[model samples]
Target chain A: MLKVRVIPTLLWKNFGLVKGVGFDSWRRVGPVLPTIKVYNSREVDELILVDITASIEGHIPDHESVSDFSHECFVPLTVGGGIFNLSQITSLLRAGADKVSLNSALFENPGLVNDAAGQFGVQCVIVSIDAHRTERGSYTCFSHSGTRNTNREPLAWAKEMEDRGAGEILLTSVEHDGTMNGYDLELIERVASRVNIPVIASGGAGNYQDMIDAVTKAGAAAVAAASIFHFTEMTPLGAKDAMHEAGIPIRRRFEM
Target chain B: MKVALINYGMGNLGSVRRALEDLGANVIIAEHPLMLLDANRLVLPGVGSFGAGMERLRNGGWIEALYQQVIEHHKPILGICLGMQMLSGLSEENGLHEGLNFIPGKVLRLDKLGCSLRIPHVGWNEVNYREGMGLFNKIPQAMDFYFVHSYAVVVEDPADVSATTSYGTTVTSAISRHNIFGTQFHPEKSSKSGKQILKNFLDYTPC
Candidate 1:
């Protein structure tokens, strides 16, 4: 049985970690290295470290920083933000990133996903989609760290990404981001049902029930949390234990 | 133990190299085939399509050198993920591509095997291997390891399979025959159980 992954997402900006509601990302958390080291022993299945400002500033990923983080990240590390071309992907891979996530670059050139999937295998190419509910009540994809509206619907965009060979999709509902309310179960179910590839549910997780809901109700293969971990006493293990108690197949043993 | 992680212009070598070094084993990131001669054991780590990986290995002149070091010299070698697939005889990914033939087998797509489950089997899954011997010594049976790949090896001989895992189907998760060892999972990225498996590999000695 495949274990449902519990991933701790560290949002990086201006040298430290931050949490924001709906992608504002203004509040300060702490450094990146220590968070990763702690997660290493915390029974989490994977770690996703995204430099929140890299793509918005039109800069490349900080290879040195990623290398340092990955050095300490014993579990599989997925690095995202500011990854545009093949060279950047190569640099990150050599820097120890098992996977790279693309957001803004995918809006500019959707073929980057195809090219990346072609060059570096689809398993390493993860396309991050930030979806916001429009005034009319339909969700539209947002880019530039959830700044600009790409005018593309989440369901259609997710299907296209899957067709383009993206191994996984990091689906985030911007309105629910940092709210600690719960995952956008409707949006997650919409996109996850549309694609055969695994969908990682992100944004709006308040407690262990929220994480379990993302997997049980929303059909997410994995659940990624930020504010719930930073703001509350909730740990990744606690979330996994809750899910495991609910009869969800999750990796409980960190070590022997 | 001297362990050389092969870099054929593919995959990430940092995590594997660091994992070995953390265990107090002398490690080398070998970009050339000649470097394999210096190490007591070779660690072939890669992440990519089967066709592209084999092309690089052949062009880089790694096939012959690997055969000499791992086959003739009997120096134990462990192949990880795509590295494990390349040890097989052929792969059907992006058309049929020939492998190193280190382990006589063919790589086939998991989805094509009537699996309703998603393609590119990603995430942690249990590996059913015999414990307390050779590669899996000290590691618990049916341990979970991280895996990310669409294809798996089907060896001609069933005894070549040292471990197996079920994900809508029985995928060959690990293979061990004589001195050749291959794992479809990423032990370096598999948390503590993986680190223990690597330690066992470092301690492995051929008869």
Candidate 2:
């Protein structure tokens, strides 16, 4: 059986890794290289790096920067933010990223995702969905750094992304983001039930129990945390230990 | 200790570089033909279409020198993923594309099997050693390795197969003929088992 992955989400702003409460107020922690080194040392199964500022500057991820991470990253790494074409995907993968994620580009042109997956393998492609709840409590898809709203239903988009050859879906609920009030269980359950590929529940992780509940109840294939880890409130190893103690089957970093 | 990783301009060589360096080997990303001269061993890392990789190597003038060095010098040569597939003579994928022809048998698109099993077999699977190859001497037979590809090499002669793993049917996972060793999986991304496999190749004595 494939082991459940525990990932720490890192944000890249101006080529530096940062962590924040939701999307704003990002604090520069360290360079991406050292941050990856730290995560690799912890025996983390995987890492997710999103370039939060790439879209604003109209710049794609710097291949050399990604190469630095892949050169040192001991585990699988997924990078997202500002990838729009087949050439960009090729550049990202060639530079060492195991997977390149897209969100805005998917809505702009749907064919790119499938085309990329066809040329490369599906395992190298991922779709990130940023969803937020309306006043009526209906989940709506958001794009362009969550500034623009698409009328498409959240669950509907999840299925579409999977059908478009996304190996995994990075689903983040805007309403629950950084709240730590527990995941929007309804949103997670809705998407996870519909999609065949793994769904990583991102945003609003407060405690170890929340992570556990997200996987067990919400059916999230993986759980991503930022504030808790960035603030040192919970370390990746600590969360994994807590989960293991709670009877969740997770891979451990065995000392060689 | 300068290890030359052949840049055919097709596959994932960066991860392989890091993996080798972790084993204390100084790795050099060598794309030019002369770069191979300064290195001790050669690693041919490949991904994407096998034919394109061969064409790139040929156009770059590295292919001729690569064949000359690995064939005559008896230096360690590790072909990873598609690099492994390129070693064979022919492939059924994207029309009949000619390979390096080092290993016999035509590479066939796994989709032809028509099994419900997903193509580009992703994630981890085990490799069962059928032959007594010292490269995997102490390694368990069913140890899982990360795989991501759609086409597999089908040997005309089974003796060249070092190991086999099943996706729908048992397919060749590793093959070796003299100094040439090819792995269909990426050892760099494959955790501890992968590290050991790389170590075994580094320590193996060539005839």
Which candidate should be chosen as best, given lDDT against the real structure?
Answer: 1
Question: lDDT score, residue A171, model 2?
Answer: 90
Interface RMSD of each: 1.6, 2.8
Give the Å shift of residue A30 in candidate 1: 1.5
Task: Write candidate 2's Cα lDDT for A1-256 as tens digits.
Answer: 2456678888888868876654666678878888888887776767899897776667788989899888787677888888889998888888889998898888889888899888777888888888988999888888877777878887888888788888888998876776677777788888999998888888888888888888888888788877777765678888889888877766644432
For model 1, what is the C-alpha lDDT against the true structure? 0.89
List candidate 1 stretches off by more than 4 Å: B95-97, B111-116, B131-133
CAPRI tier for the interface of model 2: acceptable
Q: List the residue pairs that clash in candidate 2.
A: B11-B47
lDDT of 2 by residue, B1-207 (tens): 778998777866777888888888988889699999878888887878877887898899976787778877767787888888888899877788888777787788776754347677776667888657856766777776678788888887888899888888777889888778889987777766777778777777865
lDDT of candidate 1 over A1-256, digit per residue (tens): 8889999999999799988898984799998889888888786799999988998898866999999888888798999988889899988988988899998888779999899888777888999999999888899999989989899999999999989989899999999999999999999999999998889999999999999899999899999998888988989989988998998999748454
**Per-prediction TM-score, please?**
0.93, 0.87
Model 1 chain B lDDT-worst window of ten: B130-139
Model 1 DockQ, alpha carbons vs. true complex? 0.64
User: What's the C-alpha lDDT at position A48 in model 2?
Assistant: 91
**Worst-scoring 10-residue span by lDDT in model 2 chain A:** A247-256
Residue B14 displacement (Å), model 1: 0.5
Best by DockQ: 1
